[model samples]
Target: MIHLLYLLALLLCVAPLIPGLLGVVLPAASWLPPLGLNSPSAVAWQQLLSWPGLGESIALSLFTGLGSTLLALLFTFFILRRYWDTPQWRRLENTLSPMLALPHVAFAIGFALLFAPTGWFFRLLAASGLNTDNAINVVQDPYGIGLLIVLAIKETPFLLLMSIGVLQQLQVKRLLAVSTSLGCTHHESWHKVILPLWLPKMRLPLLAVAAYGLSVVDIALFLGPQRPSTFAIQVWHWFNEPDLQLLPRAAAGALLLLAITLSVLLGLRGLEWLLVRGTRAWQLNGPTASTYCGLVSTSHAVNGRYNGAGSPQTLHPALITRLRGCATALRRRIPLFAPFVLIPLLVIPTLLVWSFAQRWRFPDLLPSRYSFRFWEQELEPLLTLTGHSMLLALGSGLIALVLTIGCLEYKQRYHRAIPYWILAIPLVTPQLSLLFGIQVATYWVPGQHFGLWVFWSHLFFVFPYLYLSLEGAWRSYDVRLDQCSRSLGKTAWQTWWQVKRPIVQPAILMGLAVGISVSLAQYLPTQMLGAGRISTITTEAVALASGQDRRVMAIYGLLQGLLPLLFFGLAVFINRRTSRYSSPYSSQGHGPSDTSSTHSGSHHANDTVRG
Candidate 1:
């Protein structure tokens, strides 16, 4: 049974990748028989490399991708190191879900509203008597700085969220206590102790960020440079060119883009190895090596905060003084999360204003006039598209959830799982590289079921994230409960249904929400597979963004953001309710065990009634 389920998962999740990749690979090799290029050759590669400004585009991609990834990593670690156990962390943690729930394309639109040359910032400058005519344009800056900054800001929240699971597993309080007791300052301890440990565990999330930075298309299309564009955008244009002869060049470009993405991923992994393994001298040197840094006093370094036991009996003057400084620094930098957290806050209102504005020209602090005309005009089409988007998201998310639970349960039963690298192929592989082949594969079917194709494509992409989200919970689940239920004469299905599901239902809900969000955010897959016939909210929004109708774009952006926010909000509410109901004292003042036995008794009663 487990073997069949494993095979089904692989078929659902990993099989599409083969055809998707081969679709591009064959054309890149000049073997597209349909195009009459029967003989394989390197002509396509030569043409791709010879394109004007190709080198500049590749350079821009590398700089933006690598730079944004490293910067976000630094910011995430700094924030975690300073405020992991501090009071400010609670506030920071609260904002992560909403910030994450906002889809990337909507965020890009909002970012442009704030930073464009004629955007809010420039308008503020104009109102303040500052010259606005010569202001720099960051939305599509030629150097890709705008794209880099936006990617870093958008990705930091995700990295921070991933770190939550890691830190919990690491037992951070004990680790900090042990390091500080060994004569290390907070600065020294995090850099020399925690960082090395954290980096190794954070490898996959970092790789995901880097991969995204390298291959992002929707955000790049909205905000990245236009003249040469990033490599991904360039490849995108080529793939969509009217002339079929140029398909090979596009295929070659996709392959090259894939190569670049893999290289960046490998480079990040190598950097991690160098820091954690290849060069260990810096980590193992000594606590006294950098103890006297301005962050920590000598007496504090010697006496330490507490012994390895993590108690707080002794408190010295130097320790007190340095601790105050650390707290102050933490408080100071804690506001850095504001701009990231505030983007959605500010952008939503700005979008709301724009959606209603009839004439809000540049340099105007507020809209000159407002009307409901845009909303009224778009209401019907908007409803239809939103319905399609929701249907796709719901169908794909639920299917992905079921498959993920099956795979994880199989792993639990067998104590073996698919390798992370294999699972991550759908994630780390550039969509441009695979989507072309997947698109072609859709052609061989007898009929064009655009909705079905889009649904399957969404399922393919959403499965990995849903599976990854549930993996930690599934692995950490205590199988003892399963055994106990079985020993009570329950079948495997009964044990899982009555015992295991209730305990991990919160995680399952969260995974479902995440998968839905992922499906909602998809732009390339919907466009490629839907073949311009189906219009989801994302497809409609991207098309409108190209036009100058800011009001319409804002409506779409807000709506695009609204669906995921609604689902995530639902997940949070359900999770809280589950926690309350599952609490030891929440069962009409009954104990936790009594509540469980009561649930079990009810389950048995229902089974007996059915029998």
Candidate 2:
């Protein structure tokens, strides 16, 4: 039965890639028989190469993709270095949940609201009597500066979350003690010892971020440039064009995108290789190296002579003055975190305010008038779209949860597991590239199953996330419970149901919530597979965001964010309740430590899920 279920899981999740790939490759080679281009040729590639702004579009994709990834990595490391293991670290961890829960699309909308030319920032400047006519352009800037910053800021928390597991495995305190004992300053310890160890483990998450930045369409549409958009956008445009003959060019563009994504991933891997193996000079440098010691001495001087508290007897006045200066500098620098956390909190209210505003002109702090008439007008369609979105999310989330459990069970029983790279493929690969092929494969089916296609496509994407989310739970779960149940004459299924299920239930629910968010955020899959026949909140929200209807956009954006937020809230509730119930079960193998393992494992499993 386990073997049969394993086969079924593979069929549901892994088998579809074949047709999806063929759907694009065949078309790219100009061999789509249905479209009447039977013979294979390079015409599509030629047209793609000859297209106007092709080079610029590719450059934009590379720049934003690689640039955002690098920035997010640096920011994540900096935050970890400054706050990890400190009293303030717990607050940073708490901050990550909301920021991580906020979907990229919703965040993009809010980002635009705050930074667009006539957005809140400029409005503030205008109110302050500054000349706002020459306001800096952020939304749709040619260089994709807005998109880069948004992606970096949004992805940093995710990297930090991923780092939790890696840092745990590294025995961070031990490493810090060892390094600092060797006369390395705290800063030098992180940069030299901790960073080298962390980077390699971070390879998968980094690739995920880079690939996402490259292929993201919805977020890019919200804030990316329009004239010569990113390469993914260019391909999306071609794919959506009315001309059927241009399908091959779109397919070719997809192929080009796949190549670029793969190349970037390989480049990242190579860079990791160089950092870890090829170049040891930087890693071998001493803590007291001339380059960093001067800076490190004044700042991370906790190890030199003064402990965390600068007591009079143990400290020199000169050292105390330097410490004071460092403390002030650090205090000034740490508020940088305020913008990342506060801006999103501010955006939520902005979205709420905009949704009800009757007329809110630029440079005005408050809406001149507010009414619910826009909500009244949008109520019916909004309900319908919300229904579709919710149904899709629930259906996909549940199914993916089931498949994940089965796969994990199979692995446990058989003492084998699916390769990490296979599981990671769905994440690191560009969704736009994969969906084009998947959409083509869907067309070969008989009738109009637009909703079914959307559900299945969502399931395909959601499976990996669910699997990754539950991986840590399954791994850390004490199989002794299973053995104890089995020894009492229960069947394997009975044991799993009676003994194993409850323990991992929290992780499962959280996985379901993650799956729902992923499904809810999907835009290209629904649009392509549904053939515009189905309209969910995301599709509607993205479409409306392009127009001048701020109220409607706000309504959908908030609704879009609200659905996932509710699920995450439920997951948290269930997890907390389960922890409370199982508090007495610590001696029986259920404990708070186990719960932490589950959450950490889930986070670790999908290190690249968000970014």
Candidate 3:
């Protein structure tokens, strides 16, 4: 059974990439058959490169994708430097999960609602008589600025949460103590110590961020700059052209996107090397370096802090500088969760009302009259689709859970684990890019196991999150109790069942919840691999959204958001109710040994404590 699951896991999680990659590659090279034209040609590449707006699209994607990622990184690091272990840190940390929970697409829609030209922001501006016509343009701005900002804000929580592990690893508290003892000012120490430590660890997550920025279709469609659109958008439009002869063009565009992802990734790698491993020069040259220069140079560093202390004690040289960084970071923390959490709330209700209202118009706020008439009409069809969706989500999630557990067990047994880079492949690559090949490989099988194909694809994409969620839990689980069990003559499996599972139950539940939610939210894999036959709430919602109908779009959008939100909530509820397993605010598995044992003073990996 164990080996079977491992094989199934490879089928579900690892194998899909084969075809998904080929699907994109073959066409991108301009050799496709479904639409005819078996012979490959560079015509597709020619057409792709010659598109009038292709240049613009590529540029927009680069700026927005790279721009938003860098912004999120800076914002994440700066915020942590301020609140990490302080009293203010607790409040900030509390905001992370909800912020992380809001899905990208739902957040985009809500962002458009709140900030579009005619959105709530303008509505308020008009009401205030504050040059409403000249109100700040936010949604769908040509530069994708609004899209990037919304994405960044939406992403801040994720970056912040990812940092929780890094901060814990960095031994932030002790690092601060050590630096302060050396006469390093708090702000300077933060810029020097925390950032340097966090950036390297952040590489994979940041790569995931960069890839999402580059390939995001749904969010960009809703809010990205469209005058030229981004490369991802162009590839999407090309793929949707419905012309078999033009398949190569679409393929070439996919190839272009793939190339762009690689380039940007390489660029980030280059940037990392420059910032970290590449040079020790700048770091050694910073003011903090003076501390290492001994007592005399410390005097010089002292003067850097006090141009003139006591201006306001807010002008207290060292005090004020530290406060400034912390206070600014602290401010971002409070409202961080509010908009992130509340937007999902708004989307759920609005979409629910929308799905039911037949002729509901805008500007009136609430639906004038409500009816389940649409539900009555669509229920049977929607139910079948929902059945398909549920089966896939549940199946993929459980399979993912088993594989995740196996990998975890493997690590515990051998202290060897899959490299994070390998695990993050699905997260870091474009889903469309990855699935392009897998989709073809599926067709290669010459069978009608579309449901199985789709289920496996969903599992492929979702396992990382499930695995990540459980990794910390498994690590933090106490081994001493298991040893006791062994001493009492219980076998390993028995030990895991009776002792290990209970303590880490919350993490398991949380991992399951996350896995299920990710499965529920899959769009690209389902649509592409299912060949338009399988319709989940996401594919349906996305399709309906394309119609641009306020009422109908909102309706589908709500269902799309609700399905995962429901699962995510249940997971959280179970996790919380199963308290004593782990604290809600607690990082995964923080055994005291984490701090005292390996890498003491290393707040860079806060999760070690969670263990």
Candidate 4:
């Protein structure tokens, strides 16, 4: 019976890949019956090759994807290594959850506002008497530096969050004490000992970041170079073109994008095994890594030499004043992190403002006038859309939760689950690229249910995150408690329901929240699979955001993101309730100490954990 349920669940969760992949592949290969191209040929591939700057586009993809990923890793590492175990670590850990909660679109939009030529900073520069003619033009620059920075900053908090578990699991105190006794500094301990273990655990999250960077369309569309967009954006434009016949070409591009994504993921895995885990030649042969740990010498060393700064006297009044100023600077710098968090704020307003203004045109800075007419007119139709969106989010989120629990249970019994590379398939590539082929393949299936296909697509995509979210909880769970319960005569199912479930309730809630948010924000899969018949809130927001209206766009954008945020907030509330003194189990007095909401990796959490 369990096998049947697992098979059904696996098929429901993973079967959509067939349609999605085949949908993209058939068109990509120029073998489509509907378009009257009955014969299969290499024409689509040829056409993809002939596009101008294809090489540069690939280079941009690789550079942006790899660059942003490596940069995020380095920055996250520095942040944790410098702060972990220090007085500031708690505050940093606390800040990561909220920062991570902000969505990518919201972050990209805010980044453009902060750094664009006519960005808010440019306005301030104009006020400061700086030459205003050329506002630095960082936004949408060909080099994609602006885009790279946005991705790096946006993902930093996520890496930090993922690191929390790995760091706690590896036991930082033992490593720290050993390294200190051996004459290694705190940073050195992190590099030589903690890192080798930490990097492997981080491999999954890092791959996720790499894949998102590789295939992201919305971010690339807004901030990446325009003349020759990233491969993902190029595929999106192909899909959007009025010429339906160009679908094959779009599919071809998507195939290529998927290829690149997989290749990079494999390369990242190989690189990690080689450098961090492969051999300890660098660990033994090379000098201690502490000097290299504090700051990536590459970014700092060059700057130091070029700038020729002076060393100040320590413990002197001037030095104390400078230290105090540095401390103040760090406090103020927290808001600089706000572009990732606050951009959604402005984008929401922009989306709302645009949705209602009839005469508002681009570059006008404001709508001529606003009306509630769009809201009044569209609200009736949007009710159906909202219902569909909720139904889809709920359906996918629940499936993801079940699948995650199943995987966890399987690991408990069998000591293994699916590999990370397989799990990351839906996450690290362009949905449009992969989904194009998948969409084409979907049509080839004997029948059609746009809603069913889309729900499965969401499940495939949301699974990795749900699993990622729950893995921590599953690991942190006190298995001995289960053993104790079993010894006390409870059956496996009963113990799971009454004890284990209640203990991991917070994680389960958070996983569901993550799943819902992921499904809610899905724009490409929902739009592509639904084939224009099914419009969700995300699809509506993206469609209306392209127009000249502001008031309406802002209102919709806010709601678009707000819906998921509302779910996330609810999940957190539930998690706190059920997991904190929040649950009836709170009388167990597990409160803050039993569960830090930060780290739960210790098998003997009572003895090994200090936080």
Candidate 5:
């Protein structure tokens, strides 16, 4: 039974990629049977190369993809270095669910409201009697800088979340204590010891971010360059063209996009190897050794006790001390929370205010007049779109959760697991590339199965997130508990239900929330597979983004941001309620003192499962 379920999970999640890729490859080679173009030639590639603005589009995609990944990585490291194992870290973890719940489309919309030419910042400048006409634009800037900024800001939370598991496995607190015993400061220990281990484990998440930044269509539509849009957007445009002969061009562009995404993933993996494996000497060189070498050279220079060569050994000790002091001061002064936490705080209110502003104009801090007329006007359509979105999110999320549990249980039973790369393919491959082929394959079926395909696509994407989210919980679980249950004559199913399920319940609930959010945020699958028949909140928001009615756009955007949050809130509530009665010791008939010990042990084991 476990084997059957594992096979079913693989068939649902990993098997689709084969046909999807083949679908694109055939069309890209100009083998469309329906269009009667059976010849396999390089014409599609030639046309793709000859297209106008192709160079600029590719450059923009690369710049945004690589640049955003770099910034997000740096920001994540900084946050972890500053807050991990501290009281402040708990507060920061509390904020991640909401930030992650905010869909990228909604975030992009809120981002525009705060940073556009006529947005709040410029209005404040104008209100202060400063000229705002000459202010540099960020939203939809031609250089793709705005897109890069948004992607970096949005992706930081995910990388930080991934880091929690890695840090737990690395035993960061113990490692820090060990390093401190060797006279290493916290900052030095993080760089020399923790970072090397963290980077290799974090490679998969980093690739996922890089791939999303490169292939993201919804956010790009709102904030990406317009003149020669990102390559992904360009391919989307080609696919939507009315001319059927241009199908090959679109397919070729997708093929090219896939090539680019694979190349970037490979490059990032190599860079991780170079830093962690190839540069072992730097990491292995103890901080004490480096500090002693520097201090000795400084003392030699200060005392004018250089060797016969008579070259100054290093800067004076006093200068080195001053530099170190300055660096510490600068680090302390940086506002670590502003980018990751503060911006989302501001975005929610900005979107809310915009949705109800009846007569708001530039230079007004608050709306001059407010009313609910916009909300009233959008009430029906908003409800309809939200209903569709919720149905998809709930259906797909629950299925993915079940499948994830089966896969994890299968791994535990057989001591075998699916490869990480197979699971990550759905995440690290360009969505546009996969969806285009999948859409074609769906056409091969007899009738209209749009809803089925959309739901399946959501499941395909949501499963990976659910799997990764719950993996830490399963890995950190005490299998000895299962052994103990079996020794007590409990069947395998009964042990899992009565012993294991209650312990990992919180993780399971949170994973469901994450899966729902992922399904809610899906735009391409819903758009392409639904063939414009299915109008979810995300698709509606993206459609409204190109219009002039900020009021209507705000209504959709606000709802888009709120729906996932509601599910997350429900998960947190249920977890808290159920946790009070579901103690592991409750079933063991243990005394109060034994129960206390069990509680502490469970708490320690599940610390990494919280977020």
Candidate 6:
């Protein structure tokens, strides 16, 4: 039964990639029967190369994609280094859910409201009688800097969440203790010891971030440069063109996107290898030696305490020591959490105010006048779109959750697991690349199974996220509980239900929330597969984004962001209730220490589930 279920899971999740890729490959080669282009040719590639601003588009994609991933990575490392085992970690963890729940589209919308040329910031400045004409352009800037910033801020939470599991597996406390015994400060320890281990384990998450940054259509549509947009946006435009003869160019662009994504992933992996594996000197050099050398050579030079001959001179030793102490304290006290928490707080209210503002002009801290006319106008269509969005999200989330459980169970029993690359394919491959191919394959079917195809596509994307979310919980679970239940004359199913399910229920709920959010945020699958028939909140939000009506756009963006938060809230509520009921059983034979550990494990898993 487990074998069959495992096979079914694979069929649903992994098997679809073949047709998806074939769909793109054939079209790119100009083998479209509908277009009467049966023979393969290089005409599409030629056209793609000749397209104006092609180089700029590709450069934008690379710049934003790589740049965002790098920034997010550094920000995550800074947070972890400062607060990983500190009292602030718990508070940081609690804030992650809402941050993670905010869909990228909605975030992009709110970001524009705050940072655009005539946005709230400049308005506030204008109100203070300051010149606002020279305000730096952020939204839709020519350099793609705005897109890079949004992606970096949005992706940092995901990397931090992924780091939780990696840090746990590393037994960070023990590593820190060992390093401290060797006279290494926490700062040096993080760079020399923890970072190496963290990067290798974080390879998959980094690749996922990079891929999303490169192929993201919805967020890029709102915040990305317009004159020559990101590569993915260009491909999106090509696909939407009415001329059927240009289909091959779109397909070729997608193929190129896939190629670029793969190349970047490989490049990242190679860099990881060089940093962690190839360079042993940096990892092996004694922390004290490196620190002493760095401080004496640079710090003393800056302080004018070292002569040109590299000899130390007596120059206010007491003052220098005091200054060093102050610097260390200042570094440790840096407010790393400010931006992460503050941005979302600001964004939510901005969207809310925009949705109701009837007459809001520049340089005003608050709206001049507010009304509910926009909401009243959008109420009916909003309901219809919300219904469709919820249906797809819930259906996909539930199915993906079940399949994820089965796959994890199969791995536990057989001591075999699906290859990481197979799972990462759905994540690290460009969505446009895969969806283009998958959309072509859909035409082979007898009728327009648009809804089915869209749902399946959601499941396809959602499965990977659910799997990654649950993986940590499954790894951390004490299988001994199952053994104890089996020895008590319980069958395998009974043991799983009676013993294992309650312990991991919180993780399961959280994973479901994550899956739903992922499904809710999907724009390409719904747009391409649904053939414009299925208008979910995401599709409608993206569609409304191109218009001049900020009121209507806010309504959609608010709904888009709210749906995911609602699911997350629901999951958290259920998790708490289930935890209460199962507390007795969960604490059995496990004293306060073990109980605390179990709770922490579950909490970590919950934090890990976001997209």
lDDT of 3 at 528: 80
Writing each residue's lDDT as its tens digit, candidate 2 over 1-611 gives 66776787688788888887888898999988778887999999999999999999999999998999989998888888987877667666666666777788888887888787777888898999999787779889999999999999888877877787788789889999998888887888898889889999888878888999999899888689888999999899999999999999999999999999999999989988887777578667665457465876654555346546763234566877787799788886665466667877777887898899898888898899999999999999999999999999999989888778878998997887778878788888888878888888877778889888889989888888788787876777778888888889999878877677666666677678888888999999999999999999999989988866888888888888777878877877766666455422322323212222222114453222111
TM-score of 1: 0.88
Judge candidate 4 at residue 112 and give its lDDT.
58
Which tens-of-lDDT digit does each residue in 490-547 have in candidate 5?
9999999999888887777777877888899999999999999999999999999876
| lDDT per residue as tens, model 3, 15-57 | 6566677787887776667657678777888887788987789
lDDT value, candidate 3, whole model: 0.69
Angstrom error at residue 519, model 4: 0.2
TM-score of each candidate structure, all chains considered together: 0.88, 0.91, 0.83, 0.81, 0.89, 0.91
Which ranges in model 2 have alpha carbons more than 4 Å from their true place? 291-333, 583-611
Question: What is the per-residue lDDT of model 1 for residues 1-611, given as tens digits with 9 covering 90 to 100?
Answer: 66777788799788998889888888898888766888999989999988999999999999888899999999999888877877677777767767878888888888888888878878999999999787778888899999999999988887887776566568788988988888887878888888888898887778878988898898898788998899999999998899988888999999999999999898888899898887589778767644565445555454556667975455777877788799778867757677768776777888888899998887898999999999999999999998999999999999888887878888888877777778788778888888988876665677879888888899998988887776755765678988899999999989887777766666666678888889999999998888888889998888887656888999999899888889877865765566556532221211111111111001111110111
Error in Å for residue 317 of model 3: 17
Residues forming the 10-long window of minimal summed lDDT in candidate 2: 592-601
**lDDT comparison, 3 vs 5, better candidate:** 5
Please give the distance, in angstroms, between residue 530's alpha carbon in candidate 3 and its true position after superposition.
1.7
Off by over 4 Å in 5: 180-185, 288-334, 486-492, 585-611
- Candidate 1 or 2, higher TM-score? 2
On TM-score, the leading prediction is 2
Candidate 3 similarity to native, TM-score: 0.83
**In model 3, how many backbone clashes occur?**
39
The local distance difference test score of model 6 is: 0.83
